[model samples]
Target chain A: MHALATLIALSLASPAAPLDWHPDLSSAEAAAEESGRAMLIVFR
Target chain B: MVRPTTLLSLVASRFECVRVTDMAGVDLDRHRFDFDLTSCILLQRADGHRYHTFGGRTWEGAESHLSVPALVRVLVRTLEEHEKAELPPRGRSGPGRTVEALPPLARRIEAGRRPACIHCHSVHDWQVEAAKEAKRWRPQDGWVFPDPREFGFSVDPIEQERVVSVEARVEGLQVGDRILAIEGTPVLTFGDIVLALDRSGDGPSVRMRLLPVSGGPSASPVERVVSTSRGWREPDPLLYSWRAMKWNLDPSPGFGGPQLTARELGGLGLAPGTFAFRVQYLVDGGARAETGRSAARAGLRVGDVVLSLDGRSDFRSVDHVHAWFRLTRRAGETVILEVLREGERRRIDLPVVGLGR
Candidate 1:
């Protein structure tokens, strides 16, 4: 129970990982293709 | 960066995020969006086949249609759609064309005025320049990324896909309708609707599939159509005048000023809604000086009160007059300007000349 509590506490205390933002389309497309993930390209 | 950590993390885990700030060397053929948008989000496959898009702004403001909740909803919905869909080919099937590949923009770059970072709107400006140079630009070409409001409906900003209201002119669509598809193209976000409408061409009407919100979760989607005799995609001059691409359009009327006050209109014997504006300043110098010079040569002097252009006096403002001229008239045309000069009515012929850059 104590170990479970510690894991729960750690999960709650941990901040969400920030998005791994690729700087350009080519690199992002490559990463996406390799990972079998769709791309979210934000043009700002 | 988007936040509320948990939601953003969900997005981060499921999608490859890319933040692009410059248009230099970006593929134009693969990525299509409204060049006027300051910030636009495109969702696509690894090989650049578009799945959905999520960004738009209005003259009311850029953030009016955007919110964290709406974006999260779009991301989640896109993921759901992706899972159940047949995926396209994993790689680009055809060659790519970059923004620099545009012939007119290439010439400008060759001239050494290449910007360190080309803005999204600059691509549109270059296209307009190219079209004008080629004598292929139509007045309707200025109308782009047609707003849903132009068609008499507005969606819930938070839900993004749920209809919140419909203008009385729009028949068969209710206030609480949830859009399923536009002309058989499934739409999960406002950007999808926009792209669908843009691809709908200059058709007089559009068909939509809507799931009525009032019908509950078990309700089946129904087909509805909205149409207009006046081009539904045509933009209001007041709204369209602010677009940066207008600078590349022709017939830049030289002079502009505040609309004539009611008292001034009364004194001039003009009706309240007449296009009466005093010439405050004329474009006399710089790259656009020829426009002002053209007006001056035609006897349009500073302080002259412009009453009408080509017998039309229903302009909402001086900006409207200029927008109307640019979108409706072309170079090699002559505009008859009726001005109240020194309390006397005089007509002058102003030649609409191209401001070739």
Candidate 2:
């Protein structure tokens, strides 16, 4: 019983999946120019 | 029987300094204490002393009805009287002969720890999850985290891609550039581009299959090879030691000074409503290396008041100076410097250094 409870707790503690962005170059370029600062587009 | 009366009398005497008024329409007769947004008063007796509570959900003390100043005065007086009563006569010989003292107990017992910024202040039981989420949302707030791209190259849908082809349009590509293949393998989404780039063997050039930005059969399927520069691998906006790039212009005479004093680098003394001096970093150096030592060697010393740079009258923050330097000056070039140091006025000539990454 303790093991089962511990397993449930561990499952709850797990982090959510990372957020993803849809690739769109035009929008990306527009955002970079709008900010008037350098933009970094990172892919995981 | 008399002890309760004496304690009540003593507490009432302490509260004499504060203005007290009876609160009507409150169940003071039943619960002996009633509190509202503005004030609270206790009429009940516990252990012979009437307890008065106040200040929102967190009652400061049983005697919370008293104002802060009144409470402090009463506490100090009580401590002083207690000490006097406990002390022995001057001739007495023992620990009590000198003076009786209260052990070190906090006069104000905070109910809970205070909140503090992780970057600037220390706090207890800081919420790791909340802090981490905040940092992830605004990673720039953290000193250790580097910005995503050094050259400010951020992409929409920020993901890696294998270039199917490289083409430069005079007007620039207007979207619809697709990857046909990576190293001759069929490519699909942007994810394939990153995977292919990773798997591509160590080489100076990578060959990629390209599709035309315009949706039509290419006159001919093109295989494009792009060359990567070794120097390009070096981080742009190079990091320089902050101690090497200090310059100041004095605004005392308000920009039209015939002479400027040059003093040793003194601490930044900013006053309210005063114009600020600019601290420029060497374009080659990153923000961290942009401090006094790098400044001193770069012809800037303590106590040099900045007046103007690059036709800008306001050079207040370190960032302002850095932006001006990058936009106006080039490496190995001399820039005009008007500074006030050591009570003497002089115009010193200084050379610009390349930024380090």
Candidate 3:
């Protein structure tokens, strides 16, 4: 029950405007370097 | 995971984000983390130099230390750190080393025994196999990613990086203190702290720098060194039993069942909290058949009630006994079991043997 509620909460909490998530680390690193931005790599 | 706040969305938008669900192509050396976690985040530069790691939990629960607000705070802090253009501490980056190339895993793959899909926990499984294959497996090798509470401090879950309380003996620290670094490596999340402790491994002491809440985040940090004792990383025996890697350890008890209820214990003239459990079945025919056979040959039988192991009766449950055995006992030792069979007491000497040795 707790797990279900957390899943629901996470679904509701997800931002509506989808952030552009690179498919892999190399691509993300290339994009970060090109755009001068940091990389937030999430392992789920 | 950042909640749908405008500030969070704005902060998250500035970075290049990636969600990795599999470890297939991940460079193990460059992207090291606590595989025990279901979710982890790494804030790093384009060059793959890590600024700090985020995510981890104690045995409390999987999301016990996770907070969206805290993640937002970390994101903002990481952006600021990025703007400073300072490189991460030395040794933060590594030569690429993929998980599939891990020696044991490579061997298994070559033998056509590769898992269909490699999940986070599979990483730990491979690591244990590697250690065992090298003939250097120890009980303590199972202890990974030790929590901060093991060192006499509790990090505030919501704040994520601040100390909420300190045990009396942990000198030079106080409640509301913010941890800046562990062993000179900057730490902004629970994952970072655990990684530091994991790297420290059985060391006598750890040194950390703290920023007191009274002086706020800009305070001149104070240094504190705390010594660790033997078995300092050991969690509650019951909690330790939940580890996936426990199955890779040796000396299984060969038999177990539910802990006796209070009423059952009362009927049997036993104390409520003492160790007492009935034997439901012996592992007579399986991968652990030898263990069950050894216990049975020593006079252990189904329907017998185990009272204590080696005269120790403080265990919380039958599983606790099994965990304690694997964690503390070696292969060649003999364990004396006090059991009750048909209202008569008996002592059985069960020889401990290594599994898959």
Candidate 4:
């Protein structure tokens, strides 16, 4: 539990990792996040 | 029409029977002779009308006439003068004196300066030979014309396609993910995952193994797994390496890179001014066989904001990130990650696994 808590704390404090992932967002969400246009992420 | 007097003056200026004239009102017809002869002349009427003619048989009428034989003699003389013109004037031989140092008259006539005919009654063959020589020596490549709109940049966004690979967090997936129970089935290297998803039948889910990110004893064990319908999305066109290797200034041919804006970042659930991160999570079953290694297994999840890599502060593009991984890390190596999760920054240690193949 301490390790988990420490890990969570460290992640929040630094919030920078080489291996972090982002959830695939909806087109609407992507549009809201970016300007001009949204990125198309298709899984095949 | 060329005045007889003007034509005679032209003939006196040099030794040529036919002289080219300026036409005022109409086009003149012309023809060639069997002995490889060509001609051009301008004709004008008393009424201010004029005609220009070219490429015809030698003039035969009383109008400026020179027999072929007499024309050759004058041509020779003109060629001699041309040869004299080529040398420095001080070194030229006296008039009528043949100089061995100078080029032959025939060669000069072939060089293209002497006129074909005289303006007056004199028939000058020198000019005609010169013109023929000039016509024969055209450059090989031909003339190059310039394009009017040579510097325009136009883009057609509809034709864009890019190949990209996504490394995601999969807790239940491990190495040796089978295709219909075939062990050692290569997935990542061949890019079969995308193909499988693209050609999958009307099924609710697909199964695959995920390797552990860390090679520690606590890593998770590989297990058979199924992704629920809510967990899957239609695969986009595959981003091939050949296409994704470079970015086109014009978006017409391939997919354009993400142009992130402040607003867009916020909409993707990222904080304004915060850098975005893409993470990969590995799930491994083999590690479970070894005690304590199973706990080290981890996978990247959505919504994680990455801040740095190997202590580097800058956040590069996704492609740069992949290159960094391929260059610096090896399979089974542990990586320290700092991410923003649940509105808080957290640090996690994950192990690297062999890229799915």
Number of the predicted model whose DockQ against the real structure is largest: 3
Model 3 regions more than 4 Å off: A1-15, B1-10, B86-95, B213-218, B228-241, B256-288, B299-319, B336-349, B355-357
How many Å off is the CA of A42 in candidate 3? 2.8
Superposed Cα RMSD, model 4: 40.8
How far in Å is the alpha carbon of B153 misplaced in model 1? 1.7
Candidate 2 chain B, run of 10 with poorest lDDT = B97-106
Off by over 4 Å in 2: A1-44, B1-155, B158-174, B180-206, B216-222, B225-299, B303-333, B338-347, B351-357
Q: Looking at candidate 3, what is the lDDT of residue B350?
A: 87
Q: What docking grade applies to model 4? A: incorrect
In angstroms, how far off is B57's CA in candidate 1? Answer: 1.4
Write candidate 3's Cα lDDT for B1-357 as tens digits.
Answer: 534455555677788888777888788867888886677878888766778887876555677667667777888899998999854332224447777877888988999998777887788888777777788777767777777777777887767668887877566667888888888778888888888878875665788887877787578888877665555666545556545566666778788888888898898888766668999988888668888888899999998999888898888656568778887777889999999988899999989876855
> In candidate 3, how many Å is residue B197 off?
1.3
iRMSD values, candidates in order: 10.3, 31.7, 4.7, 44.4
CAPRI classification of candidate 1: acceptable
lDDT tens digits by residue: candidate 2, B100-211? 1111111112333322211101110122223443443221111111111221111123112222233231122223444456576444322233334434544445565656
DockQ of structure 2: 0.01
Summarize candidate 4's per-residue lDDT along B210-329 as a digit string, tens digits.
343343445553435543343233211111111121111011111112324578567666667655553333223332222113223343344455555556545445444443443345
TM-score of chain A of each: 0.59, 0.33, 0.61, 0.29
What C-alpha RMSD separates each model from the true structure? 8.2, 29.5, 4.5, 40.8
Q: Which pairs of residues have clashing backbones in candidate 3?
A: none
Per-residue lDDT of B242 in model 1: 52
Worst 10 residues of 4 chain A by lDDT: A35-44
